[model samples]
Target: MMGLPANRLFCLVLLFLFVPAAVCGASVTRTLSTAEPGAGEVFTVSLSIDGIDLGGVVETLPTGYAFAGTDHPDDRVLVRGQKIGFAVMNDTAITYSVTAPASGSGDITGTWEDFLDETDGEVAVSHVAVDGIETAAESAGEKPAAQEAAPRFAVVAAAAALLLAGRGGRR
Candidate 1:
């Protein structure tokens, strides 16, 4: 490692640390189309799964909500004990819409399970809250705020430091 250049060593270190974790480990992310959903209104919740075959998924909707459908239709879809399940395979993302029932607040729980071996470590669970039911403000349908600009000072400083180091080494 000492014989390698600084940038090369950094790249090697990062590759060794992150590549296996990214390839072997499964990751799940959940997103809500609307944070505040009004009662009896339809909303979309999406789950993105990576590095897994994604054999099945279970979602527990809030008391006042019901699963409408998914982007990918499944014949074996079932609903029991306030939980919905569907069989899927090799899908990168599954998006489903749910209808909010009478005006109320509740939580949605979701879990992803693998069909094959558990040793592959392909499982994830997530929960999201549904609030602001029956609110006049929520009915207005407010969108999320835009992201702020990232700071450029660090990039410029790094470039300057690299230039100075190069010049000093050349001297």
Candidate 2:
């Protein structure tokens, strides 16, 4: 009886040893061809991800950018709005072209979730001058120009109309 139990325990140990370990933890990186890309200029952006499963990567970029092409044409790519997801195995290297918007900058953001774990990170894209010769002046905590200017313009117009009405009444 003792020998039979020992033999079963030995088999269990060998079974555990032969099983492949699960891959844990994932890392993602984003790189741009030019440090500063101008409007309408298509630049190359590459994404290298490691330690992932067969279908566990999702990437998101801000508006005004589109996926021109990719290195791994075999890999499936799905895009919705600003987000892109991939169903791939293990590791992958993707090089794609991105056309900058008419104005401003775009940042890359993504999250990876698999049966193993979940991770997230962001990549800040650097914007050069429109001419591509100088860096644009950017203020810390300042919002995008297209988004910031609209509300302020409405307020200024309303104030100007009130002032003009007061002047007309005085006249």
Candidate 3:
């Protein structure tokens, strides 16, 4: 039989695993090709989707920004005013183009909905910087990708250590 401490430790490990998953069950990251675009310039916004398979994305563009085109199928694409929706069924990565206004700087917001799971969440916001403009992430010194991954790495390392300790006590 598992002792109280071991049982509690096991529960703690499960909590650590499930909490992050429930909070960030799935993720959608938006990236702009041209960091800073000239007035009337065309640029691309790519979405890197993870943990989603049968749903869609709805993006709301900044005022004056125009939806140009995309590689996603036409039947799955819908543009209404500044709001654009695309059915990303089975697509893990997709790219769409947009026309920067004569001059503007604003963030693009989006939401992802999983049809099968009936789950939806906000996507990470992306800034459209007109020439001479700086994004929020740029204004603040950006951290290296490795630095950003450190937290997840730490969590994984801690979990592995706990598992090893648990096994060491067994038998």
Runs of candidate 3 with Cα error greater than 4 angstroms are 1-17, 134-171
lDDT of 2 by residue, 69-94 (tens): 56655547777777777665665666
Error of 2 at 51 (Å): 1.1
The most accurate candidate by TM-score is 3
Q: Write the per-residue lDDT of candidate 3 for residues 66-161, one digit (tens) a residue.
A: 999999989999999999998877789989999998776777888888887666777766767789675556578652232132235446655765
**Superior candidate under TM-score, 1 versus 2:** 1
Q: What is the lDDT of residue 10 in candidate 3?
A: 74
lDDT of 3 at 6: 73
Give the higher-lDDT candidate: 2 or 3. 3
TM-score of 3: 0.68
Candidate 1 per-residue lDDT, tens place, 1-171, comes to 233366545554555554444344555567788856665678898887775575677777766577888777667577775698767678788788888766655556666656563422212333233455333433465433432222243334445555544554342
TM-score for each candidate, following the candidate numbering: 0.55, 0.54, 0.68
Local distance difference test values of all predictions, in order: 0.59, 0.55, 0.77
TM-score ranking, best first: 3, 1, 2
